[model samples]
Target: MTRLPASCSFTQALVNVINVLSGIGLLTTPYAVKEGGWMSLTLLIIFGVVACYTDILLKRCLESSPGLHTYPDIGQAAFGVAGRFIVAVTLYAELYAACVEYVIIMSDNTSTIFPNTSIHIGGIYLNAHQIFSIIGILIVLPTVWLRDLIGGVGASILVVLCLLWVGAVDQVGFHRAGTTLNLANLPIYVGIYSFFYAGHKVIPDIYSSMKEPSLFPLVLILSFIFCWFICTGAAISGFLIFGDSIESQKHANKICSLQIAVCTVVIITISKYALTLTPIASGLEELVPSKWSRSYGVSILIRTALTISTLVVAMTVPFFAFLMALAGSLLTMLITIIFPCACYLSILGGKLTNLQMGVCIFIAIVGFLIACDGTYSALIR
Candidate 1:
């Protein structure tokens, strides 16, 4: 029953896109490339295009179905129970993925603060597992306690600050000689880079918040263009400055002085993203109620549980590259491929021309293949 304000403008809508896309992915891009190589960059461009196509399709669906609010709503309208299930699965997957990613980032940061304190048990050394768990709890509790959109914005601002800190460090390395791009490294880096730039799932929210939804396409186009340029620059800058030393950049060990500063910034950014994910988890919990049904206590308990779980994973695994890849694969499929094409098909009601349907189908298929490839690679690795 909560109604959005009518006063929200097109600029505000664009800002939302910026906020959602500007997260740990930006920081992780360099590391992802370390794993996959320069092919990551090509994938980044490809995914960016896919993301935009999906965004437009999602916007079109929203305009066509005025009553459809959330992603789930659009799914339901398009494919009935099956669609609803797909959306439900997608949303929860995203929530859990976000949680895991955030926790891992946080734990990594914590390791920097307490380097010698490896594992703690009952007055004995535990293991990396225990340390991760502890770090996760610490980060989750504080974040869960401040669960709200406003809090999310605060978290995002922290991320922005971290990016700024990285910028400063990059400046320090500016005087250092740059490296040449290895043409052989393009594929993997492109893929990883695309994942970093991808952020189209929330387009409907952006448009809905706008005073003029009609202007949304233009706004999205411009905003994504900006994001693309920024990401490309960041990738080139990090690669040129650090070269094969990019892996070391993950721990920020190469620049020890900037380590704490960079990690703190990254953690803050990711924490904000985790905060944004809480609502999705809460919504999922609503689908199956237990003794805690309709109880305010249940809400608190569920939120707390999710936060703690996320923190534990973050602390323990601390595999930033893996989590980013997983998130990229799953979310890219849902948002960039499936949802948009489904929206178009549903809205058109099979009445579209061959060319129109062909385009939608082609995009959907391409997205599906990329997602599948990414997911397969992630799991086996």
Candidate 2:
């Protein structure tokens, strides 16, 4: 692909990255804050800082070659066709998992708002959660195939409003409970933090969109500073209100009319269905023959199959929090953190200084360890 036109201004690119970085994942951060108390808040800041640097490393790592539009292309350039295939598969797997989680979250929130919602077909009873996921798939089916992000700004606004509204309501009903946090939940908290900072998958896109791509570091720092304050406030405020009683999902707790807030979020999140699905669809399209890649029938079939498979997984697995944490541990650890460092080492070889090399090794080791512990905790709990 030739160099695309840089139509978006730097400010637009900054806001775009911010929107991608903060998604539905922020909704669960209250659980993390409640789990580790002040400790988790500190970790959130640390993670924010580390994320800024580590994600910049991804951009630098991609600098080893030009015209590398996607991770698979970079992988192929760095390694071989097999490496390319593996990277593509892993990226798509992560994306598909995310879409499934979205469906589950949307449906779960929908169910909470309407307790008695159910349907009976052929003498079988289905609750609101089950029905709404299917409904969600149908509603989102068409949007995913479209390649427009025109609704992105409106979606971001709704998400911010939902966060503030939920926090406001939780605070209004706030009552002090004896301070409590369990050490056992540290791994999960780390997982949540890792997941919350996950916008690395799109760094290449964000970088390419900027008019002054060389100044991406400035954008990274500024956006992260903004991210830390916003996320910290949201997390800590919710924790202060609910204390240790906060569940893995505060939205589902039916706290202080949270159901209504969740309803607003669910309505807003519908706009995001297409945004999340586009990457996965593009990944699928790459697997098809070039001649058939743009066939509308084939596109519909591919998307239909993708949607059904995701819905099936969502319905089968009710552990929303654990799954998100697991994705964070496994996908975020590798794709966002570990692999970038490893790739830098591989591409640059011994040209990097000892200090630079040591930093890469350190990040890889620490990320792997945290991911292992977090994945284990998510699985067990």
RMSD of 2: 2.8
What lDDT score goes with residue 202 in model 2? 73
For model 2, what is the C-alpha lDDT against the true structure?
A: 0.72
Worst 10 residues of 1 by lDDT: 248-257
Q: What is the TM-score (0 to 1) of candidate 2?
A: 0.90
Tell me, by lDDT, which candidate is best.
2
Question: In every candidate, how many clashes are there?
Answer: 29, 0
Highest TM-score scorer: 2
lDDT of 2 at 282: 70
Model 2 misplacement above 4 A = 1-7, 150-171, 177-181, 249-260
Clashing residue pairs for model 2: none
TM-score of 1: 0.82
What is the TM-score of each predicted model, taking all chains together?
Answer: 0.82, 0.90
Candidate 1 per-residue C-alpha lDDT over 263-294 given as tens digits, one digit per residue, 9 for 90 to 100 = 55545544464455666656756765576656
| RMSD each, Å | 3.9, 2.8
